[model samples]
Target: MARKSLFITAIVAVMVLGFAVSAYAIGPVYITWNAGGANAGTGGPHQDYRLTTEKCAVCHSVHAAAVSNAAAGEFGPDPIGAAETQLLLRSSVADACTYCHITTNVSGLQIYNGVASNYTTDDQYGHNGSTSAECADCHAVHGADTFKGFIAGKILKAQGNLVSNVSGGVQTEAAATLNTLVSGGTVFTAPAASDGDYQVTAFCTRCHKTFSDASETTITAGGYFEEWDGSVTFGSRSYKNHPLKAAEATFVASGANYSGRVAWADAYTCRSCHAAGNNRVSTSYGGPGGLVSWSFPHWTNGNAQFLVSGWGVSDANIGLGTSGANTGKPSGSHTVMDGAEDGVCLRCHTNGSSGPPNNATAGVNVTF
Candidate 1:
């Protein structure tokens, strides 16, 4: 009887070992926001991070799903089947994001206030249009092939194809195709400390095509794009217009007189100058005026017209050295002024002994 018991124990051990090895071989499983948790069906305050499970029911169900296409409804039906788009619980990708992103309750990633203000009202604040903007339009919920910031598709391509891909034209390409066209186009699998500005520019160029063209020279229209490019050369010098991507690297390496107030290494992205709660914004911008709760780059406080407080060109406090206190709110227009100190142009470029080349007070102006 004892020998029989020992033999059974050995068999059981082998089965358990085999199961563990098989699980390890399968590798890490990725989950989404809506599935596999104690709070799965409870709704409203959704989880901030992804869960781990094989259940697609988080965002979809095999049967008894929602029937309505209403924006306020919890789920929308998939006509084809549950497998199609994974039987998405919402009508569309944008709706899924809105279900949680629109809120005044500070629990979830609140981008817009559903009760007070929303994306529909503040259309100019982000990538909104007559049609509701899709979150998947800009971000890949699962992952991207070449980009690391959860970018949805490829915006970087050969210089020849740059305009076509960005100007409301091609939009995105497959990872393999994108890699074949552009050098160093492989996805940055690892998370980097800084949001890649080069990639960020490509992302923005998808919609704002004319403003991102590097070859543009009109000074009135295409100049903004060129200025952001920072690599454009004129005569013998590479014009450092506000410094981005490699141009920023050159500036920082040159040991130019940076304010040392903002950490330039981390503040190189488009959001650095534009997002709410940025260090550059003055505290006097007022309550909830220049403040956005979510950290995502696409969202910002409605005030200051998307530009941080201290950086507005038309602020009543400009040149008064008052930091725009009680200066009212931003116009929400893209208008910029020449040689304006209150705007973002002077945050890094001041005449505080740094002198010319790096300092804008030496005659450089970013107004448009």
Candidate 2:
């Protein structure tokens, strides 16, 4: 009986060892957002970073092609990588993101990095620029929801009042909250009442903090002016500024065209100008232009302002004034003063004047 038991134990040990070795050689499995098994039917809030065990291997190698660095939880001593150790497949964040985003996946949808042909122009590239931004700069790779609740899609790291205002090397402003945005949809609409402040606006302000300040004086107080929220008496002209944050009801009542503007979920957030390419379905401004068709705060026709397309020198008859619409042809000149009645502006305000609207103008100047 003892001899028989010893023989059975040896056979069982061999089988287990062989199975482990086979599993190790097979590489790692990749799971889609809606794959079968325990993770089937999982939604976006918890999809990318939660319960999806296979997803981790897609980006990271547990035992990378290098000596192990047990201290940093990564394979260490890799000459071509970072010291802190992310164990990324590619050396840098940009390369890894562009590897997938730059091309069309099996789904046939290009999310971040468009095809090379479509993104040929200077303004066509947003965060894809080599020096501009990386995927990790915005997105949370290993999952942002620490408390087992849905955060926003693309997993925005912070929301609500957690705006970043770093000045003189220290964060001068109050630290903004984290993960307050807990809603997701085709369009990033309003969240639950208890979620937080206007998340999209606050998220943008994390980098573009100048826009968050209420006063232009404070925004440009350093003597170098940044005309983000409209300027005050700079270079002999005053551009009519739009409100960055405000109640949608009040803004619509104050008169700027909200028709076909999708980002106006609850308030006039930063997304009003800087949003996804397809969000603007309005045909008012000679259909959507190429520059506007790309995501904002990234691609901008080399203009640096990141203003959407239709900003070119073309007259658009928006039926704003009692006078007939400008429609086609230059009713106004292309001089710097009038901005040639750019269609980008007309997309919102009725054609106010031959020149940029003054503070007295009711169409562009709506008080919150």
Candidate 3:
């Protein structure tokens, strides 16, 4: 009996080892996002030092590529229905992302993860389809539109208070700002509330949520200053913005004429549809035209701007040398900005855990 038991144990061990090898060996699609992150508490921003799916082993299970098949949703012939929803590597979208990014205190790994929530408080603000979706569903690692895998889909805008200050020397400075705005863009024009402060967008209203004007600011200035044109360039921290801008046509490249206007001229008005790159390694890193966006101070209390690179959610950061710095674009334009794999990042890539020490320290100490 003892000898038979030993033989059985050996057989089981071999099978388990084989599965492990297969998981890492297969050529499966990659998905990245770790819950227990590498830079959990030692950070400038949680996204700055985090890593993503550019690497191979991040996804495939050499021991068992079964999960790969499962994660791929289906492999059908006609309609692509070879499997059920459960056939994919995950049940929920977050499951697949969390697979490589296993957000636990696992051994031999540096990670930090949060519990997957059944509910979303940020739901009312960020996105309706913005529930914890999978990283792969919304991303294409190679041959992605823009630079890193920017989703070529309907992009959302932020809805919040436009935080700005009035220059004292100017009379009816509010009215002056109102008269200066261009047509077709009027959050900069005054017709809403009249605080005359600059613009601030919130994720809660990324699409179109009626913002509660609890602390209302009347629209005093109504002009699209090229300086404040969030279309091409995001304005200063104290930029004046209105409640919402009608932007549902900015992501796609210009095949049609916008009456001489090009798409992607605005933040919210974007659409996406990318073709995969034929060659992955020799593919060009870019500049001036990949996926570019303004960083919202989501993580750092309006103090940091995440210069995202990948999709809206696939926040990644690989170590950069001079050559690799501007890998996304043909040339590089390094300003006071941050970059991510999937378009999620911090504003300042220079500084580290250094911040308004006292203020952050006090805030950190408070219980949630």
User: What Cα-based lDDT does every candidate model obtain?
Assistant: 0.35, 0.35, 0.25
Q: For model 2, how does the per-residue alpha-carbon lDDT over 302-356 read when each residue is reduced to its tens digit?
A: 3234333232112332111112121111223122222223445543443234443
TM per candidate comes to 0.44, 0.47, 0.24
Error of 1 at 330 (Å): 16
Which one is best on TM-score? 2
lDDT per residue (tens digit) for residues 67-186 in model 1: 543323233322322222324354344355454345422222344434323555445354442343455665544332324332222222223333343333322332222233233443
- Mark the 10 consecutive residues where model 2 has the least summed lDDT: 319-328
Model 2 off-target regions past 4 Å?
A: 1-26, 29-52, 63-92, 106-109, 116-125, 145-151, 159-164, 167-197, 212-242, 245-267, 279-293, 296-306, 309-341, 351-368
Per-residue lDDT for 76 in model 2?
25
Off by over 4 Å in 1: 1-52, 69-94, 103-108, 113-117, 129-132, 141-146, 149-190, 196-198, 210-268, 275-296, 311-342, 351-368
lDDT of 1 at 131: 43
Judged by whole-model lDDT over C-alpha atoms, candidate 2 comes out at: 0.35
- TM-score ranking of the models: 2, 1, 3
Could you give candidate 3's per-residue lDDT for residues 1-368 as a string of tens digits?
99999999999999999999987664443334332354332211111223532333333323333422342333211121233233233333334333322232121221111222311223211111244323343233221221111111111121122322322111132223323432323332223322111211221222212222211334333222223222322222223232222223332333533332121111221111110010011111121212111111111111112222221111112111112222222112223232222122211111122232322211122211
**Cα displacement (Å) at residue 224, model 1:** 13
In model 3, which regions exceed 4 Å deviation?
1-54, 61-63, 67-94, 100-113, 118-122, 125-143, 147-368
